[model samples]
Target: MVDLASLPPQLRRAVDDEMRRLRAGDGVLYGDMTSEEAHDLESADGRALPPDGALDRFIAHATVPPADVAASDLAGYTLVGVVPEGPGLDGPWSSVKRVYRRPDGVLVMLHEWAYVAEGGGVLGVRELMNASVRHGTARCPAQFAIRRAPTGQTVSELRWFTDAKVFTLSVAQDVLADGGKDHGKAWMLRLAEAIE
Candidate 1:
Protein backbone atom coordinates (compact mmCIF):
# COMPACT_ATOMS: atom_id res chain seq x y z
CA MET A 1 0.00 0.00 0.00
CA VAL A 2 1.31 3.46 -0.81
CA ASP A 3 1.50 6.19 1.75
CA LEU A 4 -1.16 8.17 -0.03
CA ALA A 5 -1.42 10.89 2.59
CA SER A 6 2.26 11.63 2.32
CA LEU A 7 2.14 12.10 -1.42
CA PRO A 8 1.78 15.52 -2.98
CA PRO A 9 -1.78 16.54 -3.73
CA GLN A 10 -1.59 16.13 -7.50
CA LEU A 11 0.21 12.81 -7.19
CA ARG A 12 -2.35 11.62 -4.71
CA ARG A 13 -5.06 12.42 -7.20
CA ALA A 14 -3.18 10.67 -9.98
CA VAL A 15 -2.72 7.59 -7.83
CA ASP A 16 -6.39 7.57 -7.00
CA ASP A 17 -7.20 7.72 -10.66
CA GLU A 18 -5.01 4.72 -11.35
CA MET A 19 -6.74 2.78 -8.63
CA ARG A 20 -10.08 3.48 -10.15
CA ARG A 21 -8.78 2.20 -13.45
CA LEU A 22 -7.62 -0.99 -11.73
CA ARG A 23 -10.94 -1.57 -9.99
CA ALA A 24 -12.67 -1.18 -13.33
CA GLY A 25 -10.50 -4.03 -14.64
CA ASP A 26 -8.82 -1.89 -17.27
CA GLY A 27 -5.28 -3.28 -16.70
CA VAL A 28 -3.42 -5.99 -14.79
CA LEU A 29 -1.61 -5.52 -11.54
CA TYR A 30 2.14 -6.19 -11.71
CA GLY A 31 1.98 -8.58 -8.76
CA ASP A 32 -0.38 -10.81 -10.73
CA MET A 33 1.86 -11.00 -13.80
CA THR A 34 4.96 -13.07 -14.58
CA SER A 35 8.36 -11.55 -14.00
CA GLU A 36 9.33 -11.91 -17.63
CA GLU A 37 6.33 -9.97 -18.83
CA ALA A 38 7.10 -7.22 -16.41
CA HIS A 39 10.67 -7.10 -17.64
CA ASP A 40 9.51 -6.78 -21.19
CA LEU A 41 7.44 -3.73 -20.35
CA GLU A 42 10.30 -1.99 -18.56
CA SER A 43 13.15 -2.99 -20.88
CA ALA A 44 11.37 -2.71 -24.16
CA ASP A 45 13.78 0.05 -25.02
CA GLY A 46 17.01 -1.57 -23.72
CA ARG A 47 19.13 -4.54 -24.69
CA ALA A 48 17.11 -7.71 -24.29
CA LEU A 49 18.05 -9.75 -21.25
CA PRO A 50 16.49 -13.06 -20.32
CA PRO A 51 16.72 -14.44 -16.81
CA ASP A 52 19.17 -17.31 -17.34
CA GLY A 53 22.48 -15.62 -18.22
CA ALA A 54 21.71 -12.21 -16.78
CA LEU A 55 22.41 -12.99 -13.12
CA ASP A 56 25.79 -14.58 -13.71
CA ARG A 57 27.03 -11.56 -15.64
CA PHE A 58 25.86 -9.11 -13.00
CA ILE A 59 27.50 -11.05 -10.17
CA ALA A 60 30.78 -11.10 -12.03
CA HIS A 61 30.95 -7.40 -12.81
CA ALA A 62 29.22 -5.59 -9.97
CA THR A 63 30.52 -5.37 -6.40
CA VAL A 64 26.99 -6.15 -5.15
CA PRO A 65 24.08 -8.30 -6.31
CA PRO A 66 22.29 -5.82 -8.53
CA ALA A 67 19.57 -8.31 -9.37
CA ASP A 68 18.77 -9.14 -5.77
CA VAL A 69 15.85 -6.78 -5.22
CA ALA A 70 13.48 -8.71 -2.95
CA ALA A 71 9.94 -8.46 -1.62
CA SER A 72 11.20 -7.32 1.77
CA ASP A 73 12.97 -4.33 0.28
CA LEU A 74 9.80 -3.23 -1.48
CA ALA A 75 7.29 -3.99 1.21
CA GLY A 76 4.32 -2.07 -0.15
CA TYR A 77 5.30 -2.15 -3.80
CA THR A 78 4.90 -4.77 -6.49
CA LEU A 79 7.91 -6.44 -8.10
CA VAL A 80 6.77 -5.40 -11.56
CA GLY A 81 9.70 -6.57 -13.71
CA VAL A 82 13.38 -7.14 -14.49
CA VAL A 83 15.70 -6.84 -17.52
CA PRO A 84 19.40 -7.40 -18.22
CA GLU A 85 21.92 -5.99 -20.63
CA GLY A 86 25.15 -7.03 -22.42
CA PRO A 87 25.61 -10.48 -20.90
CA GLY A 88 28.33 -11.58 -23.28
CA LEU A 89 31.22 -13.62 -21.87
CA ASP A 90 33.65 -10.87 -22.80
CA GLY A 91 34.24 -8.13 -20.21
CA PRO A 92 31.27 -9.19 -18.06
CA TRP A 93 29.14 -7.17 -20.43
CA SER A 94 25.88 -7.21 -18.56
CA SER A 95 23.58 -5.29 -16.25
CA VAL A 96 20.58 -6.34 -14.11
CA LYS A 97 17.43 -4.36 -13.45
CA ARG A 98 14.37 -4.56 -11.20
CA VAL A 99 11.31 -2.34 -11.46
CA TYR A 100 8.69 -1.78 -8.82
CA ARG A 101 5.29 -0.15 -9.10
CA ARG A 102 3.04 1.34 -6.54
CA PRO A 103 -0.68 0.47 -6.48
CA ASP A 104 -1.00 3.51 -8.62
CA GLY A 105 0.97 3.86 -11.86
CA VAL A 106 3.98 5.47 -10.15
CA LEU A 107 7.12 3.45 -10.95
CA VAL A 108 10.67 3.24 -9.64
CA MET A 109 13.38 1.22 -11.33
CA LEU A 110 16.42 -0.26 -9.57
CA HIS A 111 19.23 -0.77 -12.07
CA GLU A 112 22.83 -1.84 -11.49
CA TRP A 113 25.79 -2.75 -13.68
CA ALA A 114 29.50 -2.22 -14.29
CA TYR A 115 30.69 0.69 -16.36
CA VAL A 116 32.30 0.10 -19.73
CA ALA A 117 35.10 2.65 -19.76
CA GLU A 118 35.70 3.85 -23.26
CA GLY A 119 39.23 4.18 -24.68
CA GLY A 120 40.25 1.59 -22.09
CA GLY A 121 42.32 2.26 -18.97
CA VAL A 122 40.67 5.06 -16.99
CA LEU A 123 37.44 6.61 -18.16
CA GLY A 124 37.19 10.33 -18.91
CA VAL A 125 35.08 12.57 -16.68
CA ARG A 126 32.46 13.33 -19.31
CA GLU A 127 32.27 9.69 -20.39
CA LEU A 128 31.73 8.44 -16.86
CA MET A 129 29.10 11.05 -16.13
CA ASN A 130 27.06 10.14 -19.16
CA ALA A 131 27.29 6.36 -18.83
CA SER A 132 26.74 5.95 -15.10
CA VAL A 133 25.67 7.76 -11.96
CA ARG A 134 27.82 10.79 -11.20
CA HIS A 135 28.79 9.98 -7.65
CA GLY A 136 31.76 11.98 -6.41
CA THR A 137 34.00 9.04 -7.35
CA ALA A 138 33.12 9.10 -11.01
CA ARG A 139 35.52 10.81 -13.37
CA CYS A 140 32.65 13.21 -14.04
CA PRO A 141 29.39 13.19 -12.17
CA ALA A 142 26.02 13.94 -13.73
CA GLN A 143 24.66 17.45 -13.45
CA PHE A 144 21.02 17.55 -12.31
CA ALA A 145 18.69 20.49 -12.06
CA ILE A 146 15.00 21.24 -11.76
CA ARG A 147 14.63 21.67 -15.45
CA ARG A 148 11.31 22.17 -17.15
CA ALA A 149 10.06 19.54 -19.53
CA PRO A 150 8.47 20.26 -22.86
CA THR A 151 5.15 20.11 -21.08
CA GLY A 152 6.39 22.84 -18.77
CA GLN A 153 6.70 20.28 -15.99
CA THR A 154 9.62 20.25 -13.59
CA VAL A 155 11.81 17.12 -13.72
CA SER A 156 13.96 15.97 -10.84
CA GLU A 157 16.74 13.37 -10.98
CA LEU A 158 19.40 12.15 -8.58
CA ARG A 159 22.20 9.75 -9.50
CA TRP A 160 25.20 8.31 -7.70
CA PHE A 161 27.82 5.57 -7.85
CA THR A 162 28.58 3.16 -5.05
CA ASP A 163 30.79 0.09 -4.62
CA ALA A 164 32.00 0.45 -8.21
CA LYS A 165 28.47 0.26 -9.55
CA VAL A 166 25.90 2.85 -10.60
CA PHE A 167 22.48 3.23 -9.01
CA THR A 168 19.82 5.61 -10.28
CA LEU A 169 16.27 5.96 -9.02
CA SER A 170 14.06 8.61 -10.56
CA VAL A 171 10.50 9.85 -10.53
CA ALA A 172 8.60 11.48 -13.33
CA GLN A 173 8.51 14.90 -11.85
CA ASP A 174 5.36 16.94 -12.24
CA VAL A 175 5.14 20.68 -11.80
CA LEU A 176 1.76 20.31 -10.22
CA ALA A 177 3.28 18.05 -7.62
CA ASP A 178 6.30 18.30 -5.38
CA GLY A 179 8.44 16.54 -7.99
CA GLY A 180 8.54 13.40 -5.87
CA LYS A 181 11.64 14.53 -4.04
CA ASP A 182 10.95 12.55 -0.85
CA HIS A 183 9.86 9.51 -2.78
CA GLY A 184 13.05 9.42 -4.83
CA LYS A 185 15.18 9.93 -1.73
CA ALA A 186 13.62 7.03 0.16
CA TRP A 187 13.90 4.62 -2.76
CA MET A 188 17.55 5.51 -3.38
CA LEU A 189 18.39 4.74 0.23
CA ARG A 190 16.74 1.35 -0.11
CA LEU A 191 18.77 0.60 -3.22
CA ALA A 192 21.98 1.70 -1.50
CA GLU A 193 21.32 -0.78 1.31
CA ALA A 194 21.51 -3.56 -1.26
CA ILE A 195 25.10 -2.61 -2.05
CA GLU A 196 27.61 -5.10 -0.78
Candidate 2:
Protein backbone atom coordinates (compact mmCIF):
# COMPACT_ATOMS: atom_id res chain seq x y z
CA MET A 1 0.00 0.00 0.00
CA VAL A 2 1.13 3.59 -0.57
CA ASP A 3 2.10 5.68 2.46
CA LEU A 4 -1.14 7.64 2.45
CA ALA A 5 -0.05 9.71 5.45
CA SER A 6 2.68 11.23 3.31
CA LEU A 7 0.28 12.64 0.75
CA PRO A 8 -1.79 15.83 0.87
CA PRO A 9 -5.45 15.25 1.72
CA GLN A 10 -6.80 15.84 -1.79
CA LEU A 11 -4.22 13.52 -3.35
CA ARG A 12 -4.66 11.00 -0.57
CA ARG A 13 -8.36 10.70 -1.23
CA ALA A 14 -7.78 10.21 -4.92
CA VAL A 15 -5.29 7.44 -4.23
CA ASP A 16 -7.62 5.65 -1.85
CA ASP A 17 -10.50 5.80 -4.29
CA GLU A 18 -8.35 4.46 -7.10
CA MET A 19 -7.10 1.61 -4.99
CA ARG A 20 -10.69 0.63 -4.30
CA ARG A 21 -11.58 0.73 -7.97
CA LEU A 22 -8.54 -1.33 -8.85
CA ARG A 23 -9.59 -3.96 -6.34
CA ALA A 24 -13.06 -3.97 -7.89
CA GLY A 25 -11.66 -4.50 -11.45
CA ASP A 26 -13.01 -1.16 -12.64
CA GLY A 27 -9.88 -0.27 -14.61
CA VAL A 28 -9.29 0.38 -18.28
CA LEU A 29 -6.53 -1.30 -20.29
CA TYR A 30 -5.73 0.47 -23.54
CA GLY A 31 -4.21 -2.11 -25.88
CA ASP A 32 -6.58 -4.69 -27.31
CA MET A 33 -4.92 -7.85 -26.15
CA THR A 34 -6.60 -11.19 -25.87
CA SER A 35 -5.87 -13.42 -22.90
CA GLU A 36 -3.60 -15.56 -25.01
CA GLU A 37 -1.91 -12.53 -26.50
CA ALA A 38 -1.35 -10.94 -23.11
CA HIS A 39 0.00 -14.15 -21.71
CA ASP A 40 2.19 -14.74 -24.72
CA LEU A 41 3.55 -11.22 -24.63
CA GLU A 42 4.20 -11.50 -20.95
CA SER A 43 6.13 -14.66 -21.55
CA ALA A 44 8.04 -13.41 -24.58
CA ASP A 45 8.92 -10.04 -23.13
CA GLY A 46 8.25 -9.30 -19.45
CA ARG A 47 5.72 -6.52 -20.19
CA ALA A 48 2.56 -7.21 -18.24
CA LEU A 49 -0.03 -4.46 -18.15
CA PRO A 50 -0.98 -3.09 -14.72
CA PRO A 51 -4.37 -4.47 -13.58
CA ASP A 52 -6.27 -1.24 -14.64
CA GLY A 53 -6.28 1.69 -12.29
CA ALA A 54 -2.97 3.19 -13.41
CA LEU A 55 -4.31 4.91 -16.48
CA ASP A 56 -7.82 5.37 -15.13
CA ARG A 57 -6.57 7.19 -12.05
CA PHE A 58 -4.49 9.60 -14.11
CA ILE A 59 -7.45 10.39 -16.38
CA ALA A 60 -9.68 11.00 -13.39
CA HIS A 61 -7.38 13.68 -11.98
CA ALA A 62 -6.12 15.22 -15.21
CA THR A 63 -6.81 18.88 -16.01
CA VAL A 64 -9.46 19.69 -18.55
CA PRO A 65 -8.26 20.36 -22.10
CA PRO A 66 -8.60 23.81 -23.62
CA ALA A 67 -11.74 24.43 -25.68
CA ASP A 68 -9.89 25.88 -28.66
CA VAL A 69 -8.42 22.57 -29.72
CA ALA A 70 -10.87 20.45 -31.69
CA ALA A 71 -11.75 16.81 -31.01
CA SER A 72 -10.32 15.88 -34.41
CA ASP A 73 -6.99 17.32 -33.27
CA LEU A 74 -6.80 14.63 -30.64
CA ALA A 75 -7.95 11.82 -32.89
CA GLY A 76 -5.91 9.17 -34.73
CA TYR A 77 -3.54 8.60 -31.84
CA THR A 78 -2.88 4.92 -31.14
CA LEU A 79 -0.80 2.66 -28.97
CA VAL A 80 2.22 2.36 -31.20
CA GLY A 81 4.58 0.68 -28.76
CA VAL A 82 5.11 -0.83 -25.32
CA VAL A 83 8.36 -1.59 -23.47
CA PRO A 84 8.27 -4.25 -20.79
CA GLU A 85 10.98 -5.09 -18.31
CA GLY A 86 13.96 -7.41 -18.98
CA PRO A 87 14.69 -7.38 -22.72
CA GLY A 88 13.54 -3.87 -23.52
CA LEU A 89 14.48 -1.81 -20.44
CA ASP A 90 15.93 -4.04 -17.73
CA GLY A 91 13.59 -2.94 -14.90
CA PRO A 92 10.67 -4.35 -12.93
CA TRP A 93 8.42 -1.61 -14.33
CA SER A 94 6.70 -1.51 -17.71
CA SER A 95 5.48 1.39 -19.86
CA VAL A 96 2.78 1.92 -22.47
CA LYS A 97 3.06 4.76 -24.99
CA ARG A 98 0.62 6.21 -27.47
CA VAL A 99 1.41 8.47 -30.42
CA TYR A 100 -0.67 11.20 -32.04
CA ARG A 101 0.20 13.03 -35.25
CA ARG A 102 -1.48 16.23 -36.31
CA PRO A 103 -1.77 17.22 -39.97
CA ASP A 104 0.76 19.94 -39.31
CA GLY A 105 3.44 17.38 -38.37
CA VAL A 106 3.34 17.94 -34.64
CA LEU A 107 3.75 14.70 -32.68
CA VAL A 108 2.72 14.09 -29.11
CA MET A 109 3.22 11.03 -26.94
CA LEU A 110 1.57 10.11 -23.65
CA HIS A 111 3.43 7.51 -21.62
CA GLU A 112 2.63 5.77 -18.34
CA TRP A 113 4.39 3.19 -16.18
CA ALA A 114 3.63 1.06 -13.12
CA TYR A 115 5.42 -1.50 -11.03
CA VAL A 116 4.78 -5.22 -11.48
CA ALA A 117 3.91 -5.82 -7.86
CA GLU A 118 3.16 -2.86 -5.56
CA GLY A 119 2.47 -0.23 -8.20
CA GLY A 120 4.17 3.15 -7.46
CA GLY A 121 3.91 6.03 -5.02
CA VAL A 122 4.05 9.77 -5.40
CA LEU A 123 7.77 10.55 -5.42
CA GLY A 124 9.42 13.62 -3.90
CA VAL A 125 11.06 16.17 -6.17
CA ARG A 126 14.63 15.28 -5.18
CA GLU A 127 13.96 11.58 -5.58
CA LEU A 128 12.26 12.28 -8.88
CA MET A 129 15.26 14.28 -10.15
CA ASN A 130 17.63 11.53 -9.06
CA ALA A 131 15.49 9.10 -11.00
CA SER A 132 16.25 11.11 -14.18
CA VAL A 133 13.23 13.39 -13.70
CA ARG A 134 10.69 10.75 -14.73
CA HIS A 135 8.98 9.44 -11.60
CA GLY A 136 7.00 12.34 -10.11
CA THR A 137 4.08 14.43 -11.29
CA ALA A 138 4.03 18.23 -11.54
CA ARG A 139 2.01 19.92 -8.81
CA CYS A 140 1.81 23.21 -10.70
CA PRO A 141 -1.04 24.62 -12.75
CA ALA A 142 -2.82 22.54 -15.44
CA GLN A 143 -2.22 19.58 -13.11
CA PHE A 144 1.24 19.48 -14.69
CA ALA A 145 4.60 21.30 -15.02
CA ILE A 146 7.08 22.13 -17.77
CA ARG A 147 10.87 22.00 -17.97
CA ARG A 148 13.00 23.22 -20.85
CA ALA A 149 16.54 22.13 -21.55
CA PRO A 150 19.12 24.67 -20.55
CA THR A 151 21.13 23.93 -23.69
CA GLY A 152 18.25 24.97 -25.95
CA GLN A 153 17.22 21.53 -27.10
CA THR A 154 14.23 21.61 -29.40
CA VAL A 155 12.03 19.57 -27.09
CA SER A 156 9.94 20.56 -24.10
CA GLU A 157 8.11 18.25 -21.70
CA LEU A 158 4.95 18.90 -19.72
CA ARG A 159 4.54 16.30 -17.01
CA TRP A 160 1.59 15.26 -14.86
CA PHE A 161 2.05 13.33 -11.65
CA THR A 162 -0.43 10.93 -10.12
CA ASP A 163 0.14 9.17 -6.82
CA ALA A 164 1.16 5.99 -8.61
CA LYS A 165 2.53 7.21 -11.94
CA VAL A 166 3.59 10.07 -14.23
CA PHE A 167 2.21 11.19 -17.58
CA THR A 168 4.18 13.37 -20.01
CA LEU A 169 3.29 15.64 -22.88
CA SER A 170 6.32 15.96 -25.15
CA VAL A 171 6.17 18.41 -28.05
CA ALA A 172 8.46 19.82 -30.68
CA GLN A 173 10.03 22.92 -29.17
CA ASP A 174 9.76 24.87 -32.39
CA VAL A 175 6.10 24.08 -32.87
CA LEU A 176 5.35 24.79 -29.23
CA ALA A 177 7.41 27.97 -29.17
CA ASP A 178 6.12 29.24 -32.48
CA GLY A 179 4.34 32.14 -30.83
CA GLY A 180 6.22 32.49 -27.53
CA LYS A 181 6.20 31.12 -23.95
CA ASP A 182 2.51 31.71 -23.53
CA HIS A 183 1.78 30.02 -26.84
CA GLY A 184 3.90 27.02 -25.99
CA LYS A 185 2.48 26.72 -22.52
CA ALA A 186 -1.05 26.90 -23.87
CA TRP A 187 -0.27 24.25 -26.49
CA MET A 188 1.30 21.92 -23.98
CA LEU A 189 -1.61 22.44 -21.60
CA ARG A 190 -4.05 21.62 -24.37
CA LEU A 191 -2.25 18.39 -25.15
CA ALA A 192 -2.10 17.47 -21.49
CA GLU A 193 -5.80 18.17 -21.20
CA ALA A 194 -6.77 16.01 -24.18
CA ILE A 195 -4.76 13.01 -23.00
CA GLU A 196 -7.68 11.21 -21.47
Candidate 3:
Protein backbone atom coordinates (compact mmCIF):
# COMPACT_ATOMS: atom_id res chain seq x y z
CA MET A 1 0.00 0.00 0.00
CA VAL A 2 1.13 3.56 -0.62
CA ASP A 3 2.58 5.27 2.43
CA LEU A 4 3.24 9.04 2.39
CA ALA A 5 2.79 10.07 6.00
CA SER A 6 6.43 11.15 6.13
CA LEU A 7 6.46 13.68 3.27
CA PRO A 8 6.72 17.37 4.15
CA PRO A 9 3.43 19.25 3.88
CA GLN A 10 4.14 20.87 0.51
CA LEU A 11 5.50 17.74 -1.16
CA ARG A 12 2.54 15.78 0.15
CA ARG A 13 0.23 18.40 -1.30
CA ALA A 14 1.99 18.00 -4.67
CA VAL A 15 1.30 14.29 -4.67
CA ASP A 16 -2.28 14.73 -3.56
CA ASP A 17 -2.98 17.29 -6.27
CA GLU A 18 -1.36 15.02 -8.85
CA MET A 19 -3.53 12.12 -7.69
CA ARG A 20 -6.73 14.09 -8.15
CA ARG A 21 -5.59 15.33 -11.55
CA LEU A 22 -4.74 11.86 -12.80
CA ARG A 23 -8.11 10.58 -11.64
CA ALA A 24 -9.88 13.47 -13.36
CA GLY A 25 -10.60 13.72 -17.08
CA ASP A 26 -7.86 16.26 -17.84
CA GLY A 27 -5.36 13.45 -17.40
CA VAL A 28 -7.05 10.05 -17.80
CA LEU A 29 -9.82 10.96 -20.24
CA TYR A 30 -12.18 9.26 -17.79
CA GLY A 31 -13.97 10.63 -14.71
CA ASP A 32 -17.42 12.17 -15.21
CA MET A 33 -16.52 15.35 -13.34
CA THR A 34 -14.77 18.65 -13.95
CA SER A 35 -11.32 19.22 -12.46
CA GLU A 36 -12.80 21.34 -9.70
CA GLU A 37 -15.44 18.68 -9.04
CA ALA A 38 -12.84 15.95 -8.74
CA HIS A 39 -10.81 18.17 -6.42
CA ASP A 40 -13.82 18.78 -4.20
CA LEU A 41 -14.65 15.06 -4.18
CA GLU A 42 -11.14 14.34 -2.99
CA SER A 43 -11.34 17.14 -0.43
CA ALA A 44 -14.56 15.65 0.97
CA ASP A 45 -12.43 12.97 2.57
CA GLY A 46 -10.73 15.64 4.70
CA ARG A 47 -12.04 16.73 8.06
CA ALA A 48 -11.45 19.66 10.44
CA LEU A 49 -8.09 20.88 9.19
CA PRO A 50 -5.61 22.45 11.57
CA PRO A 51 -4.83 26.20 11.51
CA ASP A 52 -2.80 25.50 8.34
CA GLY A 53 -6.01 24.32 6.72
CA ALA A 54 -4.12 21.01 6.76
CA LEU A 55 -4.90 20.86 3.03
CA ASP A 56 -5.69 17.27 2.01
CA ARG A 57 -3.49 14.94 3.98
CA PHE A 58 -4.52 11.87 1.90
CA ILE A 59 -3.40 9.59 4.73
CA ALA A 60 -7.00 8.58 5.36
CA HIS A 61 -7.49 7.99 1.65
CA ALA A 62 -7.53 4.45 0.25
CA THR A 63 -4.45 2.24 0.42
CA VAL A 64 -3.90 2.33 -3.31
CA PRO A 65 -0.57 3.38 -4.88
CA PRO A 66 0.75 6.85 -4.18
CA ALA A 67 0.70 9.42 -6.94
CA ASP A 68 3.81 10.26 -9.01
CA VAL A 69 4.09 14.06 -8.70
CA ALA A 70 5.12 15.25 -12.18
CA ALA A 71 4.88 18.97 -11.75
CA SER A 72 7.33 21.79 -12.55
CA ASP A 73 10.71 21.64 -10.86
CA LEU A 74 9.77 18.50 -8.91
CA ALA A 75 9.40 16.62 -12.18
CA GLY A 76 12.60 18.05 -13.63
CA TYR A 77 14.64 16.82 -10.66
CA THR A 78 13.79 13.12 -10.49
CA LEU A 79 13.73 12.44 -14.22
CA VAL A 80 16.85 10.28 -13.84
CA GLY A 81 17.11 9.14 -10.23
CA VAL A 82 20.47 8.99 -8.42
CA VAL A 83 21.04 5.53 -7.01
CA PRO A 84 24.18 3.33 -7.00
CA GLU A 85 22.73 0.08 -8.15
CA GLY A 86 22.21 -0.73 -11.82
CA PRO A 87 18.60 -1.52 -12.73
CA GLY A 88 16.44 -2.87 -9.89
CA LEU A 89 19.49 -3.03 -7.60
CA ASP A 90 17.84 -1.34 -4.64
CA GLY A 91 14.27 -2.57 -4.97
CA PRO A 92 11.43 -0.14 -5.75
CA TRP A 93 12.11 3.45 -4.66
CA SER A 94 10.24 5.17 -1.89
CA SER A 95 8.46 8.49 -2.51
CA VAL A 96 10.23 11.25 -4.41
CA LYS A 97 10.73 14.50 -2.44
CA ARG A 98 11.78 18.04 -3.29
CA VAL A 99 12.27 21.35 -1.53
CA TYR A 100 9.08 23.37 -1.21
CA ARG A 101 8.43 26.78 -2.76
CA ARG A 102 5.90 29.19 -1.35
CA PRO A 103 3.21 30.45 -3.71
CA ASP A 104 4.96 33.81 -3.82
CA GLY A 105 8.03 32.17 -5.49
CA VAL A 106 10.47 31.80 -2.62
CA LEU A 107 12.25 28.45 -2.20
CA VAL A 108 12.51 26.70 1.14
CA MET A 109 15.89 25.37 0.06
CA LEU A 110 18.44 26.10 -2.64
CA HIS A 111 19.22 22.43 -3.27
CA GLU A 112 17.18 19.22 -3.30
CA TRP A 113 17.58 16.07 -1.19
CA ALA A 114 16.45 12.48 -1.87
CA TYR A 115 17.32 8.90 -0.93
CA VAL A 116 17.01 5.70 -2.91
CA ALA A 117 17.41 2.95 -0.31
CA GLU A 118 17.03 2.78 3.47
CA GLY A 119 18.75 1.33 6.52
CA GLY A 120 22.32 -0.03 6.28
CA GLY A 121 22.18 -0.15 2.48
CA VAL A 122 20.85 3.35 1.96
CA LEU A 123 22.21 5.51 -0.89
CA GLY A 124 21.47 9.20 -0.60
CA VAL A 125 22.04 12.07 -2.99
CA ARG A 126 21.59 15.81 -2.61
CA GLU A 127 22.42 18.95 -4.53
CA LEU A 128 25.95 20.09 -3.84
CA MET A 129 26.20 22.07 -0.62
CA ASN A 130 26.71 25.82 -1.05
CA ALA A 131 27.37 25.53 -4.77
CA SER A 132 27.67 28.87 -6.54
CA VAL A 133 25.68 29.71 -9.63
CA ARG A 134 26.31 31.84 -12.68
CA HIS A 135 23.44 32.86 -14.91
CA GLY A 136 21.22 30.94 -12.51
CA THR A 137 23.11 27.67 -13.11
CA ALA A 138 25.51 25.87 -10.77
CA ARG A 139 27.95 23.07 -11.41
CA CYS A 140 30.34 21.36 -9.05
CA PRO A 141 33.61 19.64 -9.88
CA ALA A 142 34.05 16.05 -8.61
CA GLN A 143 34.85 15.89 -4.91
CA PHE A 144 34.58 12.89 -2.60
CA ALA A 145 35.64 11.66 0.81
CA ILE A 146 35.14 9.11 3.54
CA ARG A 147 35.08 11.58 6.35
CA ARG A 148 34.29 10.93 9.96
CA ALA A 149 31.44 13.07 11.16
CA PRO A 150 31.69 14.95 14.47
CA THR A 151 29.84 11.98 15.95
CA GLY A 152 32.77 9.88 14.63
CA GLN A 153 30.63 7.77 12.31
CA THR A 154 32.28 7.13 8.95
CA VAL A 155 30.31 8.27 5.91
CA SER A 156 30.99 7.84 2.19
CA GLU A 157 30.17 11.10 0.41
CA LEU A 158 30.79 11.51 -3.31
CA ARG A 159 30.15 14.71 -5.21
CA TRP A 160 30.33 15.22 -8.93
CA PHE A 161 29.18 17.70 -11.58
CA THR A 162 28.08 16.31 -14.91
CA ASP A 163 25.39 16.83 -17.52
CA ALA A 164 24.74 20.24 -16.00
CA LYS A 165 23.65 18.60 -12.74
CA VAL A 166 25.55 18.51 -9.48
CA PHE A 167 24.83 15.61 -7.08
CA THR A 168 26.37 14.13 -3.97
CA LEU A 169 25.90 10.42 -3.29
CA SER A 170 26.53 9.12 0.18
CA VAL A 171 26.27 5.98 2.24
CA ALA A 172 27.81 4.55 5.37
CA GLN A 173 31.56 3.76 5.09
CA ASP A 174 30.66 0.07 5.27
CA VAL A 175 31.58 -0.32 1.62
CA LEU A 176 34.99 -1.05 3.07
CA ALA A 177 34.36 -1.73 6.75
CA ASP A 178 36.73 -4.67 6.53
CA GLY A 179 39.01 -2.68 4.25
CA GLY A 180 40.99 0.27 5.57
CA LYS A 181 40.15 3.95 4.93
CA ASP A 182 42.44 3.83 1.88
CA HIS A 183 40.31 1.10 0.34
CA GLY A 184 37.09 2.88 1.24
CA LYS A 185 38.32 6.10 -0.34
CA ALA A 186 39.16 4.26 -3.54
CA TRP A 187 35.74 2.68 -3.62
CA MET A 188 34.05 6.05 -3.13
CA LEU A 189 36.09 7.66 -5.90
CA ARG A 190 35.22 4.85 -8.29
CA LEU A 191 31.55 5.16 -7.35
CA ALA A 192 31.60 8.89 -7.95
CA GLU A 193 33.12 8.46 -11.37
CA ALA A 194 30.48 5.87 -12.21
CA ILE A 195 27.63 8.22 -11.35
CA GLU A 196 26.14 9.98 -14.40
**Estimated TM-score for each candidate:** 0.44, 0.42, 0.26
| Best-fitting candidate, scored by lDDT | 1
Q: Mind giving the per-residue lDDT tens digits that candidate 3 earns over 23-130?
A: 322111111334553343233223212313121232222122223334323333312122122123232332221233334322211111223222223212231121
Q: Lowest summed lDDT over 10 consecutive residues: which window, candidate 2?
A: 22-31
TM-score ranking from best candidate downward: 1, 2, 3
lDDT score of residue 39 within candidate 3: 42
Give stretches of model 1 more than 4 Å off. Answer: 1-64, 67-75, 87-93, 116-155, 179-196
Which scores better on TM-score, 1 or 3? Answer: 1
Candidate 3 wrongly placed segments (more than 4 Å): 1-140, 174-183
Which residue pairs clash within candidate 1? 86-93
TM-score of 1: 0.44
| Per-residue lDDT of model 1, residues 112-192, tens digit only | 555543212222222113223323333324322222433333333444554355554443443124543545434444444
Overall local distance difference test of candidate 1: 0.44
> What lDDT tens digits, residue by residue, belong to model 2 across residues 57-92?
333433321112234235554322332322134333
* Colliding pairs, model 2: 137-161
Task: Compare candidates 2 and 3 on TM-score and give the better one.
Answer: 2
Query: Residue 61 of model 1: what lDDT?
Result: 62
Best-to-worst lDDT order: 1, 2, 3
| Predicted structure 3: lDDT | 0.33
